[model samples]
Target: MSRFTDFFVRNKKKLLIGIGGFASVIMIGFVVFLLNRERILKYAVAKAIQKVENKYPAKLKIGNARFLDLNTVLVTDIALLPNDRPKLMQIDTVEATVSFRSLFLGRMVFKQFDMAQGAITAFKQDSVDNFSFLYKKQAAGETVDSTAKKTSNYGTLLNRLIETAFENVPDGVNFRNLAVLFKNDGRTINMNLPTMLVEDGEINARMTITTEALTNTMYVKGVIDPDNYLLAAKFYGDNQSKSIEVPYIQQKFGATMRFDTLSLSITNKVYKNNQLTISGESSAYGLVLNHPKIADENVTVQNGAMKYVLTLGDHYYALEPESEVRINKAIFYPEATYETRPKRKIGIKINSPDIPANDLFASLPPGLFDTFQGVQATGTFKYRMNFFVDMAQVDSLKFDSDLDASPDFNITQFGPVDLRKLNQEFTHTVYEKDKVVRTFQVGPSNPNFTPYNQIPNHLKYAILTAEDPRFLTHKGFHEGAFRHSLITNIKENSFVRGGSTVSMQLVKNAFLTRKKTITRKVEEALIVWIIENLRLTNKERMFEVYLNIIEWGPNVYGIREAARFYFSKEPSQLTLEESLFLASIVPKPKQYRTYFDAYGGLRAYPRYFFKLISGNMLKRGLISPSQAASVSTYVNLSGRAGSFIIPKPDTTHVQLMDTLQLAPIDLLDF
Candidate 1:
């Protein structure tokens, strides 16, 4: 023990000297590394470029790279070129300052960034594109398991994406002459930012966008907090007279949209407990849109705004119920949710508090509601709708919509077409493919016009059974038929059936054009609801107008004309079989001759329709079993329609009673 202690004391001084020398060596090496860090960063960047080139069918070039300061890097003459294609991107110079600590943590947080003379070009010709290499290619022979029960953290993924995007947006920036160009199939779009600056979290930018139709200069001014993912921006054209035209839509979708000014704000973005919540507001002024499917003319809105709260979780995305949408003086709350797990389902709800009738009328888009353009009204109305659908069980979908008016609600003055005209004698016009085909008077004053009481009960019941079974009892919309139609359309992925009730048909024939547009359909529905709920006309009068105005045969415009055109008799004098035959041809009035054989006898398809209609009428107690049993599918087209038939042998003489038990009633038979 004594010897060991003596030896330790003797070497203690030497040991201390050795340890100090080793520490000094490490400190000196670290200092040397810090001094040459720029070279190391450049090497790392070169290696990254090499990796990218090897993986993608593209080449990246950097003319010069060096460190400007401890954390700032300056790169010049950078270009990326895809093989056998035009250059994808080019930059004259780029300077960026990244957080040193973040770099060590495998993240690049840009504190400041500056770029000058940059251009990005995306081109496509035929089946080839310059930017295709940027997309990661799926491995060959790999198959996706669509039925796999996999749940994704949508909130987490979206939050990470947003954070990553915002991390690259520097707090201070100076950008100049950045142009982005896209060309495809002879169509070109160019957007150039002449100058953009971000100083102290305030942004100012000037941009010019050019397309085939127009060129516009736009200004963007905003305040941003990139770290917190908050931004408020205002984008406007050079002047109030100019509007920013949304690119691509006009060419790609055959729709045009433009706005004079748009304001957007992202007030908050928060992710907590695997849930991401975002709140924002968007408003636009002087917005105009035109689409053939929506309307025939441009629809213009003076002001529109929305305040929204959006939430995302593991398997669902939702717009909170607190979100509010405003149009002029009207306001509504909307809520929507989409879920991918535990059965894919989507639900939407919208409700509006009582809004003044005048405000509602005034808020309508100018060209969209042309019929109600100068309409004046008083009192108030509220609207609410709830819609839900499970993709797995679409048949169980739920849709409920309502619009309720106050007791005193009234239209003080009429617009283009007076709603009260149907109560008295009025002129009705028929349109085919947007062309005026026939114009006729729809009243007792017209010789061929048949009054409601003059129409045969058999014809009315047959038509009701064929077209809308619940037209007398329900509102303008038949929910069951609509649900069935929706299910069928969803299954077919096409609009094969329209659940048009008699009331809707009446409204369309009376006040709307037969343009087959979404706007027209919506207008027809609204008008039907208004007429029915407001009692503008009685059910008898509406149905009477429908029977009179609806086309029956070539140029046939009324029940009286139809009876003479097909059966050579008055509507009140038509028999049950003739009524059934007339109802069967109502859907294809122009093609009525197709239902009959060359011998003027009803074909098999029309025979099937006859049995279906009569069976339904029997079930509804509209006709006695004896009447249904006595019905025949045979028809002797003794009028003008008989001239169009051929002389083929009658091969469709099956008894209506025998087929009545075999044929299933289809509400859409009409």
Candidate 2:
């Protein structure tokens, strides 16, 4: 027992030494693990940086990078594009804490991560011609439209620049958060995303992308900084990837924009095709209108009004006003209101009562009124109405005259007139015969506007038969007839005929009439092409137009005067038979003539010749059967010398809009 104790004492020291050595070895292993951790983290960081450089902007700037734990690191910085410019996306600092525990075992793992203080800013600039919806805008001194001097030359150069800005960013893309795990020997990398925010007071949202190019899964979250407007975003890939300013592409443009309150929160996925499905609303105020025509001189008072809604990328905002407007009255015009909502059922009544009224039925025809009469009427009259004549629901009709007068005629002798059909016509019809001229009247003559319920069915059908038959099937211009006309004109080398529909005719008459040459025809075709894109309905207005202005006659050039001179009645009263009789002389008057008794008294001959014009057009289905029937009613349709008169609207109602901005006009859409 004594010897055992002595040996124990000496062996105790040896045992202690052995114990220390074992502990030292263990400590050394731990130190080695911690020392190489940053290296592993750096390697991972380098790999992630490479991805951003390859996929997005190449100029990634981080403020600093540091170790967060024994096996994890954190990095923060401001990001830039390859061109090195401060832009839409600017991050003060982004913290990416990465772990490297698995690196010692020949693997990578990110254990923890965080990002703070980032934002995205969107701006509308005062100078718009400098901007392009297709790409980021250039700074001052760069002419966006180099062809402003020669608009024909600038598109190519601008396109090249736009291409370069978006070349690296594939159109369809999505990203999500990453996940990683680590063990005793190896570690796992994860790209897990944190929450994110968008700009312009938008709802906050989450973004996830599934893409083959990104190995199919990426998680992304971000929030925009209210103060600086930088998007603080976090991304997670298959591996916990550490990237500096991964969202720098949007920041390349300096914060030239001042946002009111840009907020956003949303979640959506990107597919293999790289399409981002973002479902959220982003609203902004005072978005600059980028129209080139927005000059002070061009905005004062205009011949016509224009409205536009501009769209920037997927983002949209209110387009600014084009004309300086003033509000004077709250009166509503039926034509204007109906134009606003045609399909809806809404009716209003006339409000003002001060408008003086009269019935000009007797004075409406052409031969009866002087040229000065129409002008005197337009200048002196002002109209106020509750509902539009074209939009109102009509139940019955009453005809009365000033100072009490009646026409000495019977229903059977005169024939029934298609009142509803007459209202549908857009033409300015004047009836005139020698010293008797009259224009068609549209209303009850109360001086207030009223709307029409339905175009007279008979007139509608008749005009359809006589005018544009393929109106329903064709887009705007009849293709078959147009092609035929073009070929014939080309072969003949003279401008003779056309198959342009009533819509096309309206386009030619109202929107444009620059030159009277084939080139004008080419421009017309181009305009028609654009109009087709609008898809207009209710096209009957075009067929009703009366185009007899520059005529070769004696004080007679309008439908109202011509009708009154020959038929001794208003155009609205022109029977189907009388209509056919008048329609015959339109193409060329002198070619067709009626019976002329040498004794000067009216006489019926055994064989009389009348131009069968309306008949031919009806047989060809150019007009509706109802119109043909109306033409058949005129017992003695005359084709002889008559009083000349121009057709004009008997009653005119013009509504003054309170403000131009009530509808989107003035700003051009992107």
Candidate 3:
């Protein structure tokens, strides 16, 4: 018994050591499994992506992927391109997690998709964007059964994976340090999102944007269900000292603009059925506008406020369209509406009661009112306007407006600055190709400022139709035209088109330089407003000035000069086709100069341009269909007296007086 006990005690140590060795080996195996886990996960993900690509029309690539936890992966340098694009998104890092239950069920059910340091660039091709792919399309030549087959296997698995990742309502989706860029043509809009979070269909984002006019930060919180077309959100933005400073504004616009404060806020609440209620408020204070050429001049807005509420349904928003805007307590109501049904129609209205003009213009900086330095101004300025447009026949738009001042204001400075004298013969400063400003006068007493009756009806009609159909109607601005220009510019991603009014052009030609500066544009607009509102000159006078002073060709100024240069005819002798041809080259006279062959004959393209002008003239009722049909596309610039003459009534002997009801003559005629 004693010997057996000693043997057992001695062997007990060896037995315990053996058991410990086995445990250590098992522990080593487990460590090896953990070490290779990332590789296994990567392979699995790659395989799944391959399966997805086999059925769907997308490309997926991964630079490197590693397991963060048992069910989480940290993917680096991932790129997902779709629709045969180069790369739709380039993600620096993405941390994705799968639910334990989903992993166990052999499904890629994602619980989270947190992305960081990424850039998403979108391209707009023919108005179809990357997001447009979400709307499923039926495959061509596919029967119902075939279509069903298309979604089976890999497609079904991939769709299930996607549904599980998104429709399951993830706990959180975080996007950090992301930039979204949209490019159409030469224009680029960038938005930097510092932090964005999506939780239970709710989105919270804070972004910064820099544009030509302003740099601002926006905060947004919203709930959007694209599937149901439901959206609710709150937005807030502010631009104070951080706005584009005066120096930057001057650099960009060639004018200086300053605003003490600008703030905007909006709220949107939408019901489940897509009925949306929107409310917004905007305010700006201490606005200042200045142009270098207009010495000591300042246009100021001490304060401005706007508030509105709109309710939108499936068809239209802002049905009631109750809104108010006040600039220094000068209230105005501006509304536009759209109706869909039997015939689509749009209506716009702007109205305001008589407001004290001095109250608004008085805020200008000292010496800013030097133009009216010796003028005694008194009386309220009453404004009202109405416009209707048929969407189908946009050319047949109707507009009516009245801007009147009660009890005329006297201005003596206007006489010495007679705009008509300048129009007749003024300093024409040409920005030469060599970057030199060359100046010259039209003549000692140019006859180009022809009387209204001497101006050919066809020429008048052409200018009105091509340059500004609403020239005689609008006060100084055409909101609809400007909107169209802005939209087209944005869509094309470049400012290749313009919607400048004839009055604006005149102001630019007479008072401002053609430097393509934003400041110049602002100055032009301001002067046009003053001339129109203060009744500095009548519409006919403005039109006459514009026709006489505007550039027509290389060193050529005025319709009379253009007529002599192109056709060797007086302005009154221009035929309908010649008038249309002249209007077509107004915007690009220098470029179109080459359109004439070495023999001084118009090219085919120029003839085509004339035809285009004819189309617009016909639509605007400036030229009858018969007149348009009679117009010839060819233009012979041989400069022979009767080479290209097409006889028309010569109304030059008629009274050189306007028959259309003229607004009361200027209070102080120049």
Best by TM-score: 1
Clashing pairs in 1: 598-646
Q: Compute the lDDT for candidate 2.
A: 0.35
Worst 10 residues of 2 by lDDT: 661-670
Best-to-worst ranking by lDDT? 1, 3, 2
RMSD list, candidates in order: 7.5, 23.3, 16.5
CA lDDT, candidate 2, residue 193: 30
Model 3, residue 383: C-alpha shift (Å): 2.8
**In model 3, where do residues sit more than 4 Å from their true spots?**
1-282, 286-301, 319-321, 336-348, 363-376, 386-401, 407-426, 431-437, 442-505, 513-548, 558-584, 593-670
Per-candidate TM-score against the hidden true structure: 0.81, 0.29, 0.42
Clashes of each: 1, 132, 2
Q: What shift in Å separates residue 620 of candidate 1 from its native position after superposition?
A: 3.4
TM-score pick, better of 2 and 3: 3
Give the Cα lDDT of each candidate: 0.82, 0.35, 0.63
lDDT of 3 by residue, 1-670 (tens): 9898899798989988999999999888667757766555655676767754554456677888777777787888877676555466888998988764443334455678898999988777664455333323335332222223232122233333434333545566899999988765444567799998987878898888655555667676777453443345555555433332343556555777766655555543333344455566677677677775544456566677877665555454453446777876677887777666446777878877777756434432332432332233456677777877666665566666566666753332442244334434466665643263545555445545466778888888776766677778878787666655544444455774676888888877776546665545654665677687667778887887678767777677777788898888888898887887787678777655555544555555556556666767677677799988888766767464224334333332231221111111110111
Best by lDDT: 1
Shift in Å, residue 245, candidate 1: 1.4
